[model samples]
Target: MKVAVIGTGYVGLTTAVSLAMNGHQVIGVDLDEAKIVKLRQGISPIYEPGVEGALNQVLNSGALSFTTKLAEAQDADVFFVCVGTPEAADGTADLRYVYSAVAAIEGMQQAAPKRRIVVIKSTVPVGTGDQVAELLSGCPELTVASNPEFLREGSALADALAPSRIVIGAGDPGTSEVVEELYKAVDAPRVVTTRANAELIKYASNAFLATRISFMNELSRLSAALGTDIVTIANGMGLDSRIGPEFLRAGVGYGGSCFPKDTIALLQLAAQNGISLGILEQVRTVNATQPVWFLEQLQPFVPDCRGKRIAVLGLAFKPDTDDIREAPSLAILQALEEKGAAVYAYDPIAADAVRQKFPNVSYTKTAEEAVQGAHAALLITEWKQCVELPWEQLYESMAQPVLLDGRNAWPAQIVKQAGFHYVGVGKS
Candidate 1:
């Protein structure tokens, strides 16, 4: 299959690289000349585990390439629209990027009379595929399918290569079959459904996961008020067959590119339909307050942080990636700075990016260097390196060996044995 992936953002780039690795010739199109140049040099713009290697392999094999021209897509068998659909002020998705990408594809379709399969891999509102179809009605030879992607940030390559399921939603059965054939080599459950259902699945999955995180965070508050340990309670509950645990860990709420935005968009969608999504609205509210609550918990130990040095470990939303968009660590850093604290932060991969965002704040090359001379340390993201750091070494470097475990990624007993006072969410 000769595939043209439009918008070489995270999803589009990953999809192109993955498909190329699976023996398809892929051409990734993007308007940014600099980005296309970097991709041509076999460099990935985003930080995703295992993606660079796969992309390098495909580029070396002549299986994948990047271009800035839209006409290059005319000969492709499939065109995947993987552009951004950022959240607007009204909580609806801003579809300007998607529409722009669609128009570009429409122009290419006009030049080529052969029918092309256009797949929507971007997360969008329901009926968006129909809108794309309606826009391309003039061409009369294009088929649009809703095939929303479910790739996580850090593990995008792995998710794309080995997805849990492949969903194909189309108005035409023949078009859906053609899209299905593209993933025939992938051993996963295949779901054939309507375009609306496919679009809703993406939103519903993200919203439900966000809801679970909010529910757990809310429960953490109650557990703390009643002198109970959330970890113990969660562990016991997870043992039940009916209540399997995944996103039940209590923390500083869920903040990422997907969860926060999708939850709000879904709630707004319900409101526009004249229905109340009270639970989801509360979920958003709870998540919004979680970071503040985390800051409040640290106040008792560092009441007057003026001129005090504080070490922040982890900047990305999660581990193995340098993506800081909507990361709780950013809010925590801002709050700490507002309290007159001199913040020193370090992450394995996110240090330089974080420095770019917060130039005034101090950044260190190593986690120990960040911890050195700090009054207290806050473990924000659950990076494996941060989780497995030598607590004794960190304690020796810190002026005050008080630790706030935001993600609860540390062993409390070990930290205490290392002569540091440890604090974790929903734990005494």
Candidate 2:
């Protein structure tokens, strides 16, 4: 199948590259000339594991290409709208990008030979595909279908290639079949549903996952108050066949491109319909409050952070990628700076990106360097490299060997044996 993927963000780029590697001819379209140029040069704008290699393979094989012009859609059997739907001030999704992409698709339809399948891969509110269908009604030879993507940031390429399921929501059987055929290479459970259900699935999945994380964080708070170990509690709870642990690990909070914004948008959407989602509203509140709670815990350990050297390990929300958008680490860094702490941070891939956000903070090449001469260390992100660091060596170099394990990635025994004052969430 010849496919044209619009908006070369993380989802769009991964979708295009993965599909091209699966023997489809793919043309990635973006309005940003610089990004398009880089893609043509076989460079990925976002950091995702295995994507650059797959993109290289596809580009070398001549199956993948990129362009800024919307005319490239003329030869495409399927057009995927992967643009962003950022949160508006009212907590609803700002659909400017989606609307712009629809306009471009309508313009390209002028020269197309036959009706083309327009797949909405961007996460949007329920009934969005219907709105898109109405928008493109001017183009008679167009069919819109909702095919929401569920790719995680760190493992986007792998998830795209081997998704857990493929969902297609279309108005008619013909539209559903056309959308289904485009994902013929993906070996996953196929779900066919109405457009509204498909849209709600994306929001509900993200919102539920966010709720779980918030629930665990809230439990961690109570566990800490009672001087109980959350790790042990989590381990025991995970053994239950009914609970089955995933996203149950207690941490700072859930933050990324998806969960925070999507949950808020869903809440706002419910509000607009005069429905109050009280549980989801609390979920959002709990998640937002976690960083502040974490900061409060650290205050007693480092009473006066003024002029103190504070080392922050990990910047990305999670590991294996350099995405800091809505990352909890940002809040921690800001809180540290406000208290006059001279912060030194390090992440394997997020160092440069973090520098862009906090130019005043010191950045180092190695984790050891960041910890050296520091009064305290805070583990914000659970990156594998940061998790497996030589704690004893780090302890020896620091002026004061005080460690705050935010993600609970380190072994309590090992960290305590290293002669450092180890503090972990919900662990006594």
Candidate 3:
């Protein structure tokens, strides 16, 4: 199989690499020349674990290639539109990139003899495939299918090869079968449905997960007031089997390119259809305030943050990826800066991403270096390296031994024994 992947972001690049590794010739197309050049050199533009090695292997094997020219991949058997649909100001998904990709490919189809199945790997609102179908109405050979990606940031390759489900939303029966045949190699559930249903599946999945996390986060506050542990509460409920343990951990909230944008898009989609998703709205509301609430808890430990040197551990949204889009650490860092605190931060791989957004804040190579000479430290990201830091060494470096565990991912008693004031969320 020959696959043409449009866009060189995390989704497109990973898709290209995984396909090439799975005995398919893949050509990744992107508008960015610099990114294309890097990809040709076996250097991934985005940070995903094991992607560089996988890309290098495929590139060396001559199975994977990248090009800035979309017309070059006109003869590919399958074209995956792995572009981005960022959130717009009106709370809807801005699908300009998707439209552009479709338009570009449809135009190419007119000149090419090969008819490729165009699978939309980008996450879009429901009925987006219908929109694509309308756009490609002139080109009958170019069949449109919605195959939304569920790749996590750090585990892109792993998730791509072994996904939870491969939901193909195809308006045409022939198109669905062709798309399924390509994905038959993946050992996961094959969910064949209409284009609209598959689109809703992706949105509904994110919305439900967001609701669960937000519900647990709000409950974590009540748990703290009643001197209860959120972790134990989550465990007790998870053991029920009906409520499986996933995204149930109480934390600063979800922040990346996906959850926040998708939930808002869903809210807008519902409102436009004369429906009110009150629960999802509340989910959004709770998530927006979670970082602020976490920041407010730090006020008691340091009344006046002016001239206070604060260290922030983990700048990435979660961990293992250099992605900081809507990261909790960004909001907390902005608040600390506004309060006139000298902020120092460190992440295993995300410091450069954060540095691009916040140039004034100090960045360090190591967790201990970030905490040195700091009045207080807030552990925002639950990175393995950040969690396994030398607590006693950090205590010795800090001017004041105040530790605010934003994710509540640390053990309090051990830090207390190391002579630090440890405050964990929802843990009394």
Candidate 4:
């Protein structure tokens, strides 16, 4: 089947690349002319791991192409809407981008009446598929289906090619079958259901995972007061088959493109439906405060951070990606600046994004330069370079030799042996 993917973002690019590699002719559409130009040159705009190579392969095979106009892919059999639905000011998802994507395709559907099947691969609130169908009610041939993507930022290509599960949500059974046929090449279990169920599944999955992380974070706090090791507690708890090890790692907080927005949007969605999700509300609260918890830990030790230089080891939300959206490093850096501390930050790929946010922040080329001459250092994101820094040289470079492991990336014993005061979350 010929596939047209709207939006050249992470989800769309990965989906287009994966389908093209599977021998489908795919045209990835985006408004950004520069991004389209780069894609045409076999350059991936997104920095997902192992994706650029795959993109080049598909481009070389003449199975994949890109365009800046939606009209270019109007004749395709299937159109996947992968635009972003960022969080609105009122905590709901801003659907303007989604509306625009649908509106552009609605014209094409108007021409032929039953030209193509529109599959929504964006994460949206429940019943959004119905809304799209209603928007293009004039086109009786256009079948709208909800096929929310579950691709992670760094490992997007892997997730797209080998998804854990595939979901097809449509009002008509035929629409569901049509969308499912596009993914017959992908070997994953399929869930065909009502539109609302499929939409809710995407948000609910992220909400539950966020809840588990906050649950462990809450316990990590209690474990600290009782001199109990949270790592061991998580391990013992995960040993039970009912409670898996995923999302059990206690850290600063959950962030990135999904959790923070999805949790709040879910809360707003529940309230709109006259329902209250108390546990999820608490999950959002706990996750928001995790950054401040670092400040609470800092004051007792530093006493006064005025004029002090602090090295921030990482800037991205997680390792292996350049995305800094809702990163804990942002909150940590802002708090440090508020406390009159000079911040020096480093991340292999994410520094450029962080530099725009904090123009005055000392963005260094290497991790060693970031830690050098700093009063103390806080390990924010768990990059491999951060976990395996030359400890002896790092100790010699620091002004105070104080280390705060925010992600608990380093073993306390090793940092102690390197002659630096080490502090970690829920560590006794």
Model 4 pairs in collision:
114-141
Q: For residues 14-117, what per-residue lDDT tens digits would candidate 4 score against the true structure?
A: 99999897778999999999999999998988778999999999998999999997777876989999999999999999999999999989877776555578
Model 3: clashing residue pairs? Answer: none
Candidate 4, residue 301: lDDT? 64
User: Total backbone clashes of model 2?
Assistant: 0
lDDT of each: 0.88, 0.89, 0.89, 0.89
Quickly count the clashes in candidate 4. Answer: 1
Q: What tens-digit string does per-residue lDDT give for candidate 3 at 240-271?
A: 88999888899888899999999999999999
Per-residue alpha-carbon lDDT of candidate 1 for residues 1-42, written as tens digits (9 for 90 to 100)? 999999998899999998998888899999999999999998
Supply the TM-score for candidate 2.
0.97
Off by over 4 Å in 3: none
Model 2, which residues run further than 4 Å from truth? Answer: none
- Stretches of candidate 4 off by over 4 Å are none
TM-score of 3: 0.98
Q: Which pairs in model 1 have colliding backbones?
A: none
lDDT minimum window of 10 residues, candidate 1: 106-115
* Candidate 3 worst ten-residue window by lDDT: 107-116
Q: Supply candidate 4's per-residue lDDT for 343.
A: 92
